[model samples]
Target: IRAVGTGQDALGEVTIRVREGSRIVQGKGLSTDVIEASARAYVDVLNRLASGHARSSADSAERELAQGGVARP
Candidate 1:
């Protein structure tokens, strides 16, 4: 149903479900602009669940790239 909502209409709602241990976070948004709703849902997920892992991984990657990695002038 959620995929159908996001895929088949210019205006519809989207929901994302994420769970870990006993914790669950769900988000929903509706918009005539599909990108807007998608962004909203993704932001919600990142805020609720994805913040730490993604930031740590991104920081690790940045550190690797900064460590005299191959570079172009």
Candidate 2:
């Protein structure tokens, strides 16, 4: 977790990476509340994994890289 701004209104950003089988999936969230941001990040990863988005997205990225295209995160 990290802060994106300063003072009392600082935005909290959270990033979480989870390992599923042989792949690693990542999720990010930002909010004025650090805990909320963390929860959002965790839920994002869970949704991706549960919906099989992580696997397909990772496969697509690998294919793009193999074809000499940039793999975006």
Candidate 3:
């Protein structure tokens, strides 16, 4: 978790990354509550990974995101 910025209404931003086979998956979440933001980020990563295939090039991870890797509010 990291600070969003000074004077910002949000509490913090959370970033989560996971390595599946040869690819890397990333997720981010921002919220006024730190714990909630972390959970959001964690869930985001899990969802992305679940919707993705394990076999691919490193750059394919970016492609997956571009193609709309599972997202949630």
Candidate 3, residues 1-73: lDDT per residue as tens digits? 8997767575789987777766666778888888999999888888877887333444655576789984321
Q: What lDDT tens digits, residue by residue, belong to model 2 across residues 1-73?
A: 8999899999999998787876677889899999999999999999989887775557758977999999876
How accurate locally is residue 70 in candidate 2, as Cα lDDT from 0 to 100? 100
Measured against the true structure, the TM-scores of the candidates, in listed sequence, are: 0.42, 0.70, 0.61
Q: Report lDDT per candidate.
A: 0.58, 0.85, 0.73
Tens digit per residue, CA lDDT, model 1, 17-70 = 555554455566667766777778777767867554323334434554899664
- lDDT score, candidate 2, position 48: 88
- TM-score winner among the candidates? 2
Off by over 4 Å in 2: 55-73
Error of 3 at 18 (Å): 0.9
- Model 1 Cα shift for residue 28 (angstroms): 0.9
Question: Looking at model 3, how many pairs of residues clash?
Answer: 0
Consecutive 10-residue window with the lowest summed lDDT within model 1: 52-61
Among all candidates shown, the one with the greatest lDDT: 2
The candidate 3 region of ten consecutive residues with least summed lDDT is: 53-62
TM-score of 3: 0.61
lDDT: which is higher, 2 or 3? 2
**How does model 1 fare in lDDT?**
0.58
